[model samples]
Target: MAVRARAARTGVYQYAGREIDPDNTHGLRDTAVVNVLRDESAVFDERAVRSFIGKPITDDHPSQPVTADNWRTHARGTIMGAMRDGEYLAFDLMLTDAPTVAKVNAGKRELSNGYACDVEIGDFTAPDGTKCQARQKPGSIIGNHVALVDRGRAGSDCAICDALPSNLFDTLKTEKPVKTMVIDGLTVDMANADTAIATVQTLIAARDAATGKVTTLEAQTVADAATLVAKDAEIAKLTKALADAKPTLQQLRDAGKAFAVIEAKAKANGVAVTDAMDEAAIMKAVVDKAMPGNTYEGEHVRIAFDALTKDTKVDQPKVQPIGAPAQITDAHTDYLNDRAKQRAALSSAWKTPFNAADAA
Candidate 1:
């Protein structure tokens, strides 16, 4: 069988660790042999065909750096065996097939994993009024309302909701208009807190009544309600305070002054500030103003660079060195003069002189 022969020769043969033979263990079938016999002209021209025909085939070895356009066509079935059924093949292999494989892969990955929604349930409806479904995707048709489903099992309904975003489910649970609110330092227009509170209150009330301790819970509920009222009053007061404090020039100046004070403190402590402040210039200015030049003036004495470099005038006459008087003896002076003449000539000749020169 031509297929069997080709597969035996080419499938998965590794010079190193790289799979050379791309076709799986299944070699050429009888059909391929029949095709080759039927179309001798086409078969003769193909390089893969020549290799199969037992001719001398040139195997241009593959490397990681080789260009994809020039990559050898590998066996199709063999590649499938290496990868998962549904998972994508890596671009490292596909760079040979299509140079844009990476881009295509990126698009596919985005479609598969990136498009997300936190849909909130608005309502549930069914034809029979028995089985109902809630649309809970946040930006979906309906949002932030509870969908009452009568027919579906609670577990199934909950599971379906779980498959949706956590945020959407949470939003649905707290279904109402999102009023602007602050928690910690962050500004948020979150899901309605009132709806959530009412829902919780209703649940608690129902549970207490069913358990026959409604009267006992009544006292706790009153206490909780009082506490909540106090909290609301406090929040309202703060909100009013914030609202009253409108942006003014004076307020801005006060903020700037406060910032300056903090900045000064930071600089004094040698805290590293950003380039916005020009720390180098500020430091130079500080040095120039606070500790300019190497001069120290104490309480009793003043010291400065002028004191060191200033010219001093002496109050006494200059004295010359006392030595023997110069008396020229003809023999000694002439010998010295001759020696000087010879030394000068020698000095001029060599461009330098030794300690003593030869006397004429």
Candidate 2:
């Protein structure tokens, strides 16, 4: 009988009393021979024959092997169960293989609908000396298994975990949503409803101010128009009154001619007329300064006196003087008679002289 060795197991397998899987197995299969050296010098050496028999390992074994084809499905099922059990950090499916990680990522991407899922892969080492890559929510702690972010519901630690402060959870539960409005295609969130209402009121106030200014301007324009109308009416009345009071040209010329005659009469009478005196005053002064007979009343008195005293004869005659000649021219008559006698005597003497001369 020859001694024989049994074949080793490679993949996951089940035996009669135990189970073997890839988790506990390693190394490939190869053939080797057992060699024994003999020495003939010693008296005690003897040839020995042994008979050994064992069952050969066969492919007739139950296995649940993890491979690339079904690793995603198994990993997803495992992670889902761990999440439900609150043991989400226990498994590291990301470090298994590239294809397995890809499948896992795809499944994670499908978890959040219409939103981007930010799943973080972290390096971890299992207790069994295997390198692992685990999936977790972004910014999450390892042991808490809940996200460390401040969502509206206090993340996943509000109800059961109690990892946050007691007052913080109460505040989050009672907080109200912010007020929002859409302006020019952008959403604006206000602190409160009062703030949004105040903005609207500001706009209304500005519009009212503009309207008031326009109204004031219109009123001013109307007032100015009324004032202009009143001024035009007053001007028309004054123009008519002036036309009624003004003197005509012919009347002024006649008054000037009458004044010239009065001035000339006053000058001829030496009445001392001046530019300051009017026509009636200068004529009155001229009449007052006239000579008594040259006055209008004096002329009538003189004419009556002349009519009474005219053509009256004397009442008495004078007697003739004693021995006086009846003619009053006697002296002149005696001188003329003496002159005639003298002439006659001279003529007679002249004739005698002539006669004597002729007799001689």
Candidate 3:
């Protein structure tokens, strides 16, 4: 509860006329706080001033209003009347209640004025170059009562506002600086600029990280494609090598069989053959032994082999007689071999040169 004073020039209350320092510990505003001239005019208006005149003074404000009906029970004095005193609207009062006068005479003399008003909230510099957050609007000020207290807010010197600032507002809103943000061509209202900026920065960092991952994946894809191409080329090369080897393998098998025949013919012709002898040397030996006096190119050695084997082929039986059995008998088998020389000559016939074309 704010207090007031009882004095001759400064009785209980005044309007306009309240001043609070910016550096005051109350922390009301950032500059000297005062009422506007227009609001002062309203406070001193005939109806407003009359409402204050003759109002009761109490030891302290009652819980309810002290009207004419209740003044006898609550009044310690009376706010007799008021008038303009320089920039201030000063009041006069009469202390009629004995007990309250005793308290004041006993040095408890501070005063408080109780009033009602509709506060108009704003920030503005006062006529004396002070700042205030609010002032009483025109025609909205009315006097209720005055009270004597231990301490006064707006002293007789009018150094503070009269109304209880703590209860003046319907809802107290602690003001914070408003900030704005622009996103995708739209403006957004924000309570904190620093937090918004930090959030945007975090989002940008996340986007960059995702972009880096995509770039790495793209590069990896290209490398994988190149590796696949190399693998395909290697597979193609191996396939071609296999294809080129097919005919060479057939030729190698044919040459090995030809040499085996030459070695057989050389032994049959009584030309000494040894493991150390190659196909060409064995062929020459066979030719020299069979022709006895001829010296010929290596190709002529085949004539000697044909001459030696001409009499060796077994002929088919003349024609099976009507009575002959379909399965072979010992007599038929006997015609296939000279039993006495079979063991010695069998390898020669079995290793004979094969004609792949005739078999196919």
Candidate 4:
């Protein structure tokens, strides 16, 4: 075969305006290192190489060694050995055992197109009538256990077991039952096919039993029930407290009326009574309005009242007269005055009106 003239001793060449010398030793290197940029279909062989370099080499057009890009396709078969001389830079190309690369490309394609092949299942066997170990088409079968190997395929150093989909299994179940099997160089049991079937059945039963014990939905229902019970208990406790306090609230209502009467008298006199005023304000107002004689000013009110009536009932209902006001303005004024007097009197009292004894 006619070989192309070897590249310049410098091995450094310009391509697309960029100077490149592989490994930076162009001065010592006698041959050039040129990359192959041929498409997969380009044929590279002896005759192909001669045809490419038919023109005579010249000063302006020096002979360029056959780089992988311009080499005949067949040159790939011996590219590895050719690298020893550094005469050419060609890729040692082969498609054998390249499933991982295929898988990566397939993932990219799937992501771009939003489509994927459904998984298939089936039993795979080897050429020697044995099961092949997992490795591409040479490895796992996608959905079915069946593999289709065309004639003259190479690279049988590794094999593998591929799981196929159930649909494919239904179709291939009667295909001679795939008699040969291998697990890491171990043979399948010859007389224990029945045991294998039983083992699968036992595993199925155990999984079902586990699924029946506690389900996600059931757990959610249990949590909801606990929350409802707690809320109902809280509501019932509040209801009981309100029921127990009803009578005491009613008693305070009755006692608050007598205080309101005294408050009305103080307001009628143009005095600005306040809620902060104590029992002293009430006694003062009563003494001022009554303008009691020396018999009352020097003497305590309790003693004067006691002398006036010995049979006075201390616990008489002290309801304020309902005719205190007819209009809203009058009612508001009455409320303000009454609150002021109540605050003062209650402040002076040893106990608050809210206390149990005061309510009684």
Residue 238 in model 3: lDDT: 84
Candidate 4 residue runs with Cα over 4 Å from true position: 1-172, 176-192, 216-360
Please, what's the RMSD in Å of model 1? 36.6
lDDT of 4 at 2: 12
In Å, residue 326's CA in model 4 sits off its true spot by 22
Alpha carbon lDDT of residue 10, candidate 3?
18
Full-model lDDT for every candidate: 0.31, 0.34, 0.59, 0.34
Candidate 1: misplaced stretches above 4 Å?
1-219, 230-234, 241-245, 275-360
Q: 204-300, model 4: which lDDT tens digit per residue?
A: 5776677555443443444455346556766787899888676686677765775665555455544467888754565565455444343343335
Writing each residue's lDDT as its tens digit, candidate 3 over 45-75 gives: 6677777875667887676676544555787
Better-scoring candidate (TM-score), 1 or 4: 4
Model 3: which residue pairs collide?
3-152, 4-111, 4-112, 5-111
Q: Model 2 segments beyond 4 Å from truth?
A: 1-192, 247-360
Query: Which lDDT tens digits does candidate 2 get at residues 109-158?
Result: 11100111222223444334444333223322112111111221211222
Location of the lowest summed lDDT over 10 successive residues in candidate 3 = 5-14
Best by lDDT: 3
Model 4 compared with the native: what TM-score? 0.17
| Residue 38, candidate 3: alpha-carbon lDDT | 40
User: Per-residue lDDT for 155-207 in model 1, tens only?
Assistant: 22121111132542343433445565443344444455666455555655776
